[model samples]
Target: MRADIHIDSDLLQQCRKGSSKAFRELVEQLKRPAYYHALSLTGHSDDAMDVSQEAFARAWQNMSSYNPSQPFYPWYYTILRRVALNHLRSRSRRREDIDNGQIDTMLTEAGGPGEDCQSVQYSNLVQQALMHLSIEDREILCLKDMHDHSYRELADIVGVPIGTVMSRLYAARQRFRQLMKESGYEHE
Candidate 1:
């Protein structure tokens, strides 16, 4: 998620200087978003956890490459995305796990309390539709829509130009809308 939390420059400097304590603090701050973002890409809790942890390890190993002035998540996201994508690639197939139970839990968390049956069903449909999308399409959609990343953040996180981010988000939205319609979910 695009949390407004900023990594303290001091903390980052210490991390760069090989302080495991500082890096642990960084992990405490970012671990939730890291897992959730990885989950969005990997579609399984176990895989997401593994991928995010691996990304964090990689981030620590490559600490010198990080620009302390920039937001940590975006930089960390690059590692997380790479790790997640590699995991996805190694799996050799997109599993149908999203439809099973995780999507329901995610929807419940996103929806908060008092969601009706209709809302749950709609969320299920949306998740199902998302599963049908290409990984690129799904990643862009989740990064923008689910995680609240801005266009510039999207470009930075996805390693694309702002124009490419806009175009991809637009195209991904169109395809998602079509998928929703096919799943019998109509929206204005």
Candidate 2:
């Protein structure tokens, strides 16, 4: 097996033995990937953080059920993705009932200028484009590009066939390129 997979197996074994330190190490190793995956799905930092944390908590609780031979990140990410989707659903419901006062409050809270305005602007634009994508499209992009997972790994993680992963990835890239072109970005 690959070095990363070997390390992951070891960490998972440690976690299954109820070692808090091992669990912490696992979290440290997985957190950034999990957070990025969540962000790619939710298009919001707060939601990503919440989803990532919830995923880890659930993983900790269910550590005993983890199969050491399996890849850990995919298992963890599946949980994070589910949490993010649930959060999006809840947000959609709340949005229907949002009042003018709440809207104004949110705007005010978000109005502060940041130091790296250009980076923030770019990030926001990318996030907006991602938000326009279908969930499957967003997930394909996140798993293949952001997380550097292989198509086979993605298929396993998403419970889909490899052909489906390839098709979704192709469609997602085409849509993302279209979105970028529409937004005045030069698409290759």
Candidate 3:
């Protein structure tokens, strides 16, 4: 096992014993990546934050089920992904149309730098294109690129084989590139 995995196991052991410091360390380590994964899956910051929080709560409640011999991220991310997917499915009434207006509102509320006109335009374009993608594709891309998971790790999180992970990642990247090219954002 990797050194980090060993350290994670130690943390998990402490957490299982109800050590608050260990729980804080575990949450601090996993939170940002989990949030990013949720955001990429849900495409809404508010939903992602809520999902991440819920996932952590669930994880803490189910800490006994966590296998210390395995990696922690896949187990943690599985919870976040499920929560986000559930949230998406519950709103299936509004599935067909890509809500650009809501996405714009979300991006604005995220409160990043939009003062530079070019940056704002670029951010808007990226947001629109991301919204155009199916949630599944976005989730795959986010797990692979944004979360920097290995194919095996992604497969474990998404409950697929490594071959499927590779194929889907390839296809999703190609599609994202195609969308960027179609939007005239590709450089020569």
Candidate 4:
């Protein structure tokens, strides 16, 4: 784990000791990441803003429940995911289109200037396929593939064993591939 990625243990201890500055500093450090994660998971800008803020509030209100010795994000993630998923469950009956026409950016460099129409179309198809995935699958894919988090980091943030992260990633990718095939995207 990078020393910079986690807020210092001492900082967490200070928060535990009821240091308001430490708490604010912790929230400042985490706010953007938590918001982005919520945004990706919820696929709705407003919901992301709401859920992430709520997660922070809940986490702060229950700070005593957090263990100071461990990495903060993992504990925070539990709160964030619960809130985000609950939001999803409430909206499950009304399915919104997942940003149609947003191209899969991974294809950008791969396609290059020389690769034109077909590549662009393929990228769109892949993105559409991605949109069809379950929120948990999408979150796992984002953490592992998009953000390039290693298995251990994924395990920490996801509150899963490293082995489970690997297995889940494999399953998510497999389902992604299936979706692509269903969407008329043939792997090149």
Worst 10 residues of 4 by lDDT: 100-109
Query: What is the C-alpha local distance difference test score of candidate 2?
Result: 0.71
lDDT of each model, Cα atoms only? 0.83, 0.71, 0.73, 0.78
Q: Give the TM-score of candidate 4.
A: 0.82
In model 2, which regions exceed 4 Å deviation?
1-6, 93-125, 185-188
Per-residue lDDT for 54-144 in model 2, tens only? Answer: 9899989988888777777667767777888888887883322322221121113345565366655555556556667787798788678
Where in model 1 is the C-alpha error above 4 Å?
Answer: 94-99, 110-114
Best by TM-score: 1
Reference-based lDDT, residue 34, model 4: 79
Clashes of 1: 0
Which 10-residue window of candidate 3 scores lowest in summed lDDT? 1-10
* Decreasing TM-score order of the candidates: 1, 4, 3, 2
lDDT of 4 at 137: 90
Per-residue lDDT tens digits of candidate 4, residues 1-188? Answer: 12134788888888888888998999888877777677667766677889999998898888899987688888998899999999888776444555544324333545566778876877777667666788879889877776677899889999899999999999999999999888777777
Could you tell me how far off, in angstroms, the CA of residue 77 lies in candidate 3 after the best superposition? Answer: 0.9
| Candidate 1 whole-model C-alpha lDDT, 0 to 1 | 0.83
Best by lDDT: 1
lDDT of 4 at 8: 84
For model 1, residues 1-188, the per-residue Cα lDDT tens digits are: 46554678899999999999999999998888888888888777888899999999999999999987787777998899889989988887735434345645554676767878898888878888877888789889888888798888888778889999999999999999999998888898
* Model 2 residue pairs with clashes: none
* lDDT string, candidate 3, 1-188, tens digits: 11121235677899988787898898887776666677777777677789899998998988889887777777777787788889889867364554454445434544565467866776677677777778878778766665567777778778889999899889887888788778878746
Any runs in candidate 4 off by more than 4 Å, and if so which?
1-4, 96-98, 101-123
The per-residue C-alpha lDDT of model 1 at residue 172 equals: 91
